[model samples]
Every structure is written in C-alpha cells, then in structure tokens.
Target chain A: MSDLSPVPASAVVRVDLPQQPYSIAIAAGLLDRLSVQFQDVGLTGKQVLLVSNPVVFKHYGDRAIAALEAANCKVTTAILPAGERYKTLRSVSKLYDVALKARLERSAVFLALGGGVIGDMTGFAAATWLRGVRVVQVPTSLLAMVDAAIGGKTGVNHPRGKNLIGAFHQPSAVAIDPDVLRTLPAREWRAGMAEVIKYGIIWDRELFERLEAAERLDRLRDVDADLLHHILTHSCRAKAEVVAKDEREGGLRAILNYGHTIGHAVESLTGYRSVNHGEAVAIGMVAAGRLAVKLELWNAEDCDRQTRSIEKAGLPTHIPLALDPDEILAALQADKKVKAGKVRFILPQHIGAVTIADSVPRDRLREVILGAMGNG
Target chain B: MSDLSPVPASAVVRVDLPQQPYSIAIAAGLLDRLSVQFQDVGLTGKQVLLVSNPVVFKHYGDRAIAALEAANCKVTTAILPAGERYKTLRSVSKLYDVALKARLERSAVFLALGGGVIGDMTGFAAATWLRGVRVVQVPTSLLAMVDAAIGGKTGVNHPRGKNLIGAFHQPSAVAIDPDVLRTLPAREWRAGMAEVIKYGIIWDRELFERLEAAERLDRLRDVDADLLHHILTHSCRAKAEVVAKDEREGGLRAILNYGHTIGHAVESLTGYRSVNHGEAVAIGMVAAGRLAVKLELWNAEDCDRQTRSIEKAGLPTHIPLALDPDEILAALQADKKVKAGKVRFILPQHIGAVTIADSVPRDRLREVILGAMGNG
Candidate 1:
C-alpha cells in the first residue's frame, strides 16, 4: 500500500479494543531484536508467560528468553505437546501450572510462540489466567504470524471441533518475524500462503495479482520475502481496520470469515488432521463462492478465478466427503453469527469486492453444494 | 443500595463489562424459573451445553433439559468427574465431545449448574469452546453463588497449584438461586460465609457489624435472605466495578489482592487442600494488617479491629506451620505480580481505604510472618 517500501519495524496494525487496543508488527526478524520494541508499547520489564511446545521451544524459546533478559524483563516457559487435541482444557492446565510455578501476577504478560496451535492454546491460557493477562504473540510459523497471530482470537479446540473452545482476547503486541518461516516445511509454508492469498480475494485484488506474479517476479529460490512482507503488512492492516471498527465478529468483522464456516466444519469432521487449515479454507472458499454464484450474487467467472488462484498456490479447492453439505448446513444453524438460524456469508461478487449477506435460500444452497462438487 | 423487597425471588447483581459485560442474577428457584429470566437478557432459544458432574447432573440435569426443551432450545450434556483433578484437559475433553455430538455452534451457551469446581471448570470450557461461547452460570452452591458465581472469573485448578488455569470469561448471565444451597453440607455453607463476612471488614464496617450480630453468619443457615442479598450485592458491585475498569488487572486492580500474596503461598505450600480461598484470605488479611502497622502505614487500632473482626467470623486469623515461611516466600518470588522478585502487599491504612505498595522490605516480610505465627 505504501509503494512496497520496507516499513519501520515498529510499523503496527492496530485492532481497536477500547479496554485493550493492540497492534501487530510484521518484520523480517523482529523477535531476535525485540527488547527495544517492548518499551515503545508501554510494556515495561514485567513478568512474561511464554507458552509453546517442545519443537518450537527448541527452535525459538532460547532466543525469546535472551531478548527478554536483555531488556531486564523476566520470562517463564510452558512447553506443551504439539497438535490439535493438545489444544484443549488439559493443555491449558499445564500452562496454568507453569505460570503458577512462576508466580504469574495478574499484570504479567503472556506471550505465545510457535504455530497456530500453540498460539491458540496459549492465547486461551492467557485469556483465562487471573481472568486475563496482557498477551503478546511471537508467532514462529508463517500460518501463525500471518493469520492466527494477527487476530485477538485465541482458544483451545474441543474434540468436537477445531477451536471449539476459545476467546476474543487480543494481544498487546505481536512480534512477527517472517524469517521464522525459513525453517518451516513446504506444506506448512503453503498452508500459510493460502491465508495470505485469501486477503487478495476478500479485500484487495492487487494483493492477489502480486501473489500470482511472484513466480515470474524478481525474488527467487524461496518465497519472495519482500512480496511476503508487503502481503503481510497489507493483510494485517486490512483486518486491523475492520477489527478496530468491529472488535467482536458482530458485523464488519464477519466478512473476514470469507472461507471459515464450512472450513470449520471440514476441520472438525476431519479432526484437524486430514487437512491443514488453509487447505480446508481453500476448499471452503470455493464452495462459498459457488453458493454465492448459485444465489446470483456473483457469476461463475468469479468462482473460476478464485478457485484457479487457490489451485495455482497449491491449495485445495473442492469440498470432500469428510463433510456432507447437509451437516455443514446443520452446523451453520448454531453459528454465532446466525440470526434466527440463518447462515451468513462473506462472498465475492468479483475480484475487487466481497459482500456480507444471509440471503442464500435453502434450495439454492443445495444447488451450490452440488455445483461446487461438479455433481449434477 | 435499594430497599429490601422480599428478595424478589432472587437478587441480581449486574457486573457491567460495557465493552463485553454480562449480568449476574442471584436468585431463588432458578432451576425451575430460568427460562423467563433469560429472556430479559436478549437470550432466546439456542443450544445449551449443560456442564456438571454426575452427582449434581442426576439431581438437576433432567430439570434443566426439560426447561430448555420447553423453550424449544436444543440441549446437550457434558459430565465431568466430581473433583479438582478432573478440572484438567481431560474433563474439558468430555464437554467438547458432547458439544461435538450436539453440533454446538458459536451462539451455543454452556450452563454450569453445580458448585465452585463445576462452575469454574465449566465456565472455562465455555470460554475456550469455539474461542468463546456464552456461559450462563446456575450456581447451586452457597460458595459458588456468593463468591465464584458473582465474579466473571472462570478457570480450572492445576495439579501444580490452584486456579493456575482459567479465564476472565464473564457469563452472558449468571442465574443464581439461593434455594439451590439447600443441598449443601454445613461445612460448605460455612466456607462460603467467610467471604461474605470478609466484605464487611475490609471495605464495609457496617456489613461487618451486621455479620458480627448474626448468631450463625459463619454457618450460613437462616441468615436472612435480604441481608445476604445486600451482602452479595455490595461485594459483587465492588468486584464488578474494579473488573469494569481493569478487566485485565494492570495496576489499580491489584488492591483486590489484599491478602492473596501470602495466602497463595500458604495454599501452594500446603497443596491448596489445607484451606479454602476464603479461609486463607481471612488469615492473610490479619497478617497484612499487622504488616501494615509494622510499616507504620496503618494505625494499630485499625489493625486490632480488623484482627478481632476476622477472628469473630470463624475464619483463620493466623498462618499455619504446614509450610515454612522461606518456602512460602520462594513461591511468592514466582508470583506474576512480583517485580525483580520482591513481593508486594495491599496494606490497609484504615477501613474503606488501602494502598498497593511494594516498599515492604524482605527482612520485614519474614518478621511479619514470624509475628503471624505468634513468634514475635
């Protein structure tokens, strides 16, 4: 948005919560040099609760600890097990124990390090410990730093569904260093990219074009870091502006769920193991677009353009049998966004704009599912 | 603050979290009459996840199920084991499993219809489920309705320490009916009364005098419903107002920990079973008073009055030898509130006013402990 110039490391994307307004920082390696950053945010050397798992602890814990220590700030660690099931009340227990062992005061800071799973569980832990703690996220994975880390949405998963248990506890500051993704596996990297691309379809088509042109553009070998940074900053700003206006997903915020309703059902039915979050969302996005087209909100061209982009990024674009359209429809019955059991949508009319509506009829919904499956 | 009117079949204390605040309604006959009151809060028919243990569920679950059904709301049940240990990830798993079976959506609510343990664990489960869902507490215990139910705080205890895992998740509405306490044991009733009496001494001398005049305020039997409602409202208002201003407890909220610093250490040293929260606070308050006097921050007369009041409430006014003061201090060193490892105190200068200062010296802290044990 600012002519692709590298912004200051302190450049922040704010999510306005009058009770606790927060900012998200996206830079190449902010975590390695984070001591000074904490000061600008009014966060003095208070105790910080660092929640992560074994793998992430080994990779980034020591560096985080050193950074805090450099600033003369105290930090403690709670390394939980990795995976989705571990993102439950039980895992929160272990985190609580560690904080208790550290004697975390109500004013202590809770930092989440690692992937979406770690951030989710740790954020939920912070959301509840002593009613709540000031949470700061140091996301180590691309999927986490770009998507999960930016939103104040934090929670553990109920076995019934992914992120079935959670809170809207926003972070005080998010120290995101995209360089952390250098060590991530190709799959995880791609999963995060799916979300990055999502920003293009939902709010800014220029982002989509840039992402589509990356392969032919200058940066090579790995994903273009500059391109990545630009996308990250813009996407974060987009969500931040909306979140600032709609702290809770009550109105404008719901449009950000461009691909999450059916995506959540897919994740739940598969128990979050069969598909990575982005892949499920990729499929869900396609399905939602088809539904929009069926309802005459958008034409087939919009559907094809979006699905092709997801496919080009190596993301899935079709719903699987793991979830039946009927079941997803049923799950929608209880969505927090539903007013009187009607499913809501954040569907695109074209590449440049999206619509938030609940006008899709039942028969049209069925036809959309069938069309999305290319089945009838 | 309002004139007594036969308790109105219930007493509702509104804890305003204007940013995301919900109300707490403490009443009688809530189990049979929740449907009507819930409608007053913008709540209509929706799925309800009733979380409780087998014992309480057997007695009240059927009635809950019947009530929700009459209102045409879908209902599901998740039963955890009846103990503190079950307040782990394992227990939350049961809730998740049931919620999944019922296909709970974001609008779904979890009803915690039991005592403190159930209320805490269930509240946490709701807080994390789907990142957050509405929690409607129907506290059935005197301890819960008077203390746990009144606060928006919800969490589970960790094996390492009590309330190590939790969230400041306010229930969308707390349906508190004092009639539920009829089943509580005498010991249970007495435990809850300690907190009731505590409000009078630390903040309201008038409430203290009233409790002192009661023949069995500690036992909590036949303790005039209106007086109890008055006591409950005063304490809740104090807590709710603090929470409204500082939901995350940054600075001004620290005074709420008047006796918690040392009391927490004592509880940790003795494995939490040694004392209930109110019991610990009773002694901690006295200890804090003496320390305040020793530091010349509080007058001796005020400390004497506070001590005598605590003693008269049938609460412990002395620290126990079950733990060494050194070990207690070590644990205090880990408190999230401690800065550079020095413990702080909320010392009262007089009734109705207190100061949160960390000027207490370590040698003085040790001496205060010695005096609390009658060694001075």
Candidate 2:
C-alpha cells in the first residue's frame, strides 16, 4: 500500500443531500486540488472562512489556506485552541467574532481546516450565522477526513453534555488531504487508525481483514501519502454512503456510532483530556464486541480478530481508570440516546454488522462494562 | 372567510420529517389534544417539561397543566416571570436547571406554553438540554403561533448580540391552537398581525386584500374558532413549507425576515423594554418599504397599502419616539444579517413580491431611516 506509484483514485464518496449533494474528495493532494470538488458542487471561488486551531495551523493549516487561495478562493483564517474541551459556545464565539470582524458575506463558504472539534464548531457557526451558509470541509487529521468530515453533525458541547447544542448542517464539499497526516503525532495517528478499523468492523469485514493482515501499519501509515489517501477514500465513502441514506441519524447513521456510546462516557469521565476520541472509541469497540459475544451475536473468533487489530494498531481495546459502574451507568442514563430510561447500545451482530439495541438490561450492561475494564 | 360552517376534522399543518413527521395542529382543541401530535412524533405519554412564565400561568397555566396531564403526559411545569428582559442566557441556564431537576429523557418533550419570550427561552433550553430532545411548540400568543412557532429558530439573546447564541432546532411537533389567542391583549394581537400582514405582502396578495378589507378584525378579533383556525392554518403552512424546504435558511429563508433587518435594531435601541417584537418589526417594515421606494424597487401606493394595513391592524408602522437614526444605524450594523459589513435588507418589489437586496447604499439607508423617524 505504501508503494506510491501514482495511486488510482477510487470512487468519490457522495453524501446525497439531494437538496445539496456534495462529494468528499479523500485523497492526497486533494486539498491542493479543491477546485474539483467545488466544481462538482457547482460553486466557484468565493469568499471562504478557513477555520482551524493553533496546533493544526502549525501543521497543515497554512497548506490548506494556500490551496484554496491557489484555486482562486478568497480566504480568511482564524486559528483556535485545539481540544474537545474547546468545542463550546464560548470557544465557537471566537470564529463568529472572526467572521463578524472579517465581514464575511452570507454566501461566503466556511472551510473547516482541522480535526473534528474544529469541523463541528465551524459547521455550527456556519449553520447559525445569518441563519446559515455554505461549509466546505478540508479535514487534515485521519479521524476528521473520514468520520467527522463526511457526516453533517455540527455542534458545540454543553458543560453538562457532549454536543449538547448543534444542527444537522451539510457541507458543500469535503477536501480530505491525507498528506497532512504526515505531521500528526504518533499517538493521534494510531488513534485515528481505530476509526479506520471501525469502518471495517461495522460495515466491511473485508476491510477489517485487510487491516488485520497489515500488522505493521507503516505500510498503511500517513508517511505514505498515496496509501493514506486510499485509506481515507475508502473510509469516507463508507461513512458518506451511510450518511446519504440517513442524513439525520434516523436509522443507518446510528450504525456509525458503533463504539461511541461507552466511548463518549469515557471521554466525558476523563474530561476528554486524557485520551483521543478514537482511542476512547477503540476501547468502546472492544466493550461492545464483548457485549455482542455475551449476547451470542458474535463468536469468540470475531472478537479475537478485533482484539488483535486494535492492539496491533497501538490502540487501547479496554476500559480504564477503575471508574464506578454507577457513574458510567448514570452517564448512560443521561445519554442523548437513552429513551424511556433504557440505555441504547450499538452492538455488533458480527464483524461488519451492528444493531441499535435499546432494551439491554442495566445489570447486564454493568456486567459487560465491568468485565471489559477488568480485562485491561 | 369568517362564515365557515364545517371545518375539517383537523386544521393541523404537518411537517413531514421523513423519520418524524409531526404536525402543526391548528384546531381550536389542539391545546387540549396535545397527545395526538406528541404520539405522532414518537413522543408517547412521556414526561413533559412545561416552560412558561407567571403572566401566562396566572391566566391559563393550571388549565394547560391539567390539559397535558389528562392526556397522561407526565407534566412538570416551570413557571418563570413574564418579561422580555428575562430572555437571557441566565434565563436559559435556569431553564436547563429546571429540565435537569425534572430529569427529562430523550423521549420526553418540552412544551413551550407561553408567548415569544417563553417560546424562545424554552426552545433554547430544549435545543441544548442533554444534546437536544423533542420540543413541542404550543405557542400561546398570535406572534408565536404565526412567526416563532413554526420557524424552529430557537435561542437566547446574548448581551453583545441578539440571537447570537442559538441553534436551528426543529420542534418535534407544533401544536398551535388559536383558542389561546382569545385571552391575548389587543396590543399583543396587533403585534402579531404585523407579521401576518408582512407575510401577505410578501407571499399572498389575496391575504393582503382580505386584511385591507377587514374594517375591524371581528372574525379574527371575536376569536370565532372556525375562522381563527382558517387564519392560523394558512399562516402555519406558509412558514412550515418555507422551513421544510430550507431548514437552515441558506437563501429562500431570508425572505421570511422581510422586516426584521431594521426591526431588530429598533428593539436593541429600546433595550427591549419599550417596543415588542411584532411592533418593532412592523415599524421596520415601513422603514424597509420607504427604502424600497427610494431604491425604485417598490411603488408609493404599495407602501401606502402596507402602512394602512398595519395601522388598521392596530400595529405601529412608523418609527417610535426619539430614536436617533445614527444610533439605530449603529445597531443595524450589528444586525445578524449584516454580512460583508453591509446590512442585507429584504425589500418588496411590489405588494406581493419580496427580494433580498444586500447592496443598499449605507448613506441612502440611513437617510430613509432618519426620514421615517421624522428627523432627517
């Protein structure tokens, strides 16, 4: 995969918002070639609001801004602090202030040039300012290029809840430049691989099998820009297809939240500071897999394959910090998915297949969470 | 329009959210029949957090609570003070505290049971609580039923800006019973008529003609159940259809804020204490129309028709008391629709036509505004 012999572009993932159908261009040099996606979306170089954070600015933000500017897109930049904790109304106020200060027109496109936090906050600001505007996703990180950039879940987290305030605002185009990931920290790179592996486990077992075979991920690593692009293209297409069918997370979209239930709680428990989102979700995937196995939805071998790939990719597949079962359970009760006081868990029926089970008994859930933590 | 004999079984205008198709039930008994909309939107006889204020509660709170309870919806009512000054983040925080205290779950729906102030505050709370849940719009005043209820534009005003902190969160369902307007004061009802007249001038000339012909809104004023439902049905459908097609308000939605450009500034200048939302927007409509004639987009006769309709509705179509044009213009600069440092105004092309023009010269705009204030 790392042999950069001019990789053939795979199918572009189309998020079919019939009202505003857009393609996610997931490949290396795609950011530099953003005009293609914009052309496909029927938009020309207009005023663009480029949103990124300081860390991402230090990495790929300049490249992104330059690329759009090169494409004749009028661009202005605002760099925010990087972190999930910063995904707040107050934090997003920085971007709103910039847009206001820059005198951005209603038709101006908001180009998100960082990770999921930046993307979510930027998309939301775009959604509300002057009622709404166009958003273009130029995701830099592996996690953002695939998961965050593809779906249109734009929001800011409340002090009491993750993504407590949000809107389902779709982007006009997504420019996923995998080349930017070369500068990513090793931990974040590995963490992002967890979501890459997640796409395979939840939808395409073939992809998972390929990942399992690639024990040493350097072949699949960000250093190899073309190979990295291929990975993002595949992952983004899978996510985009799902989002297309259900833009508002009514049905198929929930499948995408496979490991996020427990993952969200873990991040919240640790104040979203200790572990990356993907790493926390990696642990969540393992826990959900265990629950599925206990419920006879999957066999031991399938679970073992998950374990190997997760660990091999250098991602955690177990819970941490001896958290109280009651606290986790309480958070579960407070979960946005909790309906009728019942916890909703997305469990794997088998590798590449999942279901939203809303009736899982609390005691049984507590056992699965405790068992997963003990395994660590 | 008042001589209606047999009204349909339901006058409700339903918004078909593919996954959750909820209704804007416009029957006289809708406030009493809240369960129908709730159940249709997948909100069963679940817990309801009713957010209202003392003014509404002192009048109809007990009956509203009883009506909801009779339907087996576990109702927890939070009565706040009735004042525009109370529409703040601090108020929203209090609302969140109330929802937290009631332990609102995902299935639970918040019933906004008062006027615009209550609806805005409660809807903002619903938009942010536990990352959002179902919000049932039971707007009591004429302003809310026609303007705010169906739009799904919910938020709390920031000190620095109005509606700066908000989200486009659609209510699970809107239960608009025009019966509630019977108890509303004439001043409040006239304020709502401004929106009604504005909508007519923009969308339906026939509606405009009807208002122009009505010497006294006896049909509307007497609160004749059948006639009132007919009136609300058209209003709700007009707003809902616009919203459904453009949920986030990219372009077509801008038409709905026809008079709000200057209207909002008028409110801000007065500290929200003197001018009501509808009255301010009414005056703003006159101001915008004057600019329209100046820009040669609208005729003087069309302006007279609109101004006369507003006056007949018992609404203010002229700028009120001692407001300096420069101060108002500064406030207008801070208007949410001021993009690229230019205020985007929705001006009428003719009596029945509206176009969003962002290129109005500032000096010319200030001239029209000052002239309307009788101090140019």
How do the residues B1-376 of candidate 1 rate in per-residue lDDT, one tens digit apiece? 3464544545556677665677777656667777875677655688888888788788788887787677667778777787555666567667777776777777788888888888988887777766677888887776677667655677765666567667777777777666666677665676666566556545666776676566656555667676667766666666666667776566766777788888777766777666767677777788888889998989998778776656655677778865677787777776556755667888887777788878688888889887776320
TM-score of chain A of each: 0.91, 0.93
Docking class of 2: acceptable
The reply for model 2, stretches above 4 Å from the true place, is A1-11, A35-43, A218-230, A374-376, B1-23, B27-30, B36-42, B78-103, B124-132, B158-161, B164-172, B203-255, B292-302, B312-314, B327-366
- iRMS of candidate 1, Å: 3.2
lDDT of 1 by residue, A1-376 (tens): 3445675433567777676777787766688777766786766678888788888788888888888777767888778888776777678777777777677777688888889988887787788776677788888876787678876888765545456567888887888887776667677776777777778887788888887776632122355556666777877777777778777677777877888877776677667787778877887788888877876878898678777777767777766755677876776665545555677778888775789878667787776665555210
Consecutive 10-residue window with the lowest summed lDDT within model 2 chain A:
A218-227
TM-score per candidate: 0.85, 0.88
Write one digit per residue (lDDT tens) for candidate 2, span A249-276.
Answer: 7678888888888988887887888767
For residues B196-286, could you state the per-residue lDDT of candidate 2 as single tens digits? 8887878777667767776665225554454455557667777777777667677887889998988998887888878888888889899
> Any residue pairs clashing in model 2, and if so which?
none
State the lDDT at A114 in candidate 2: 87
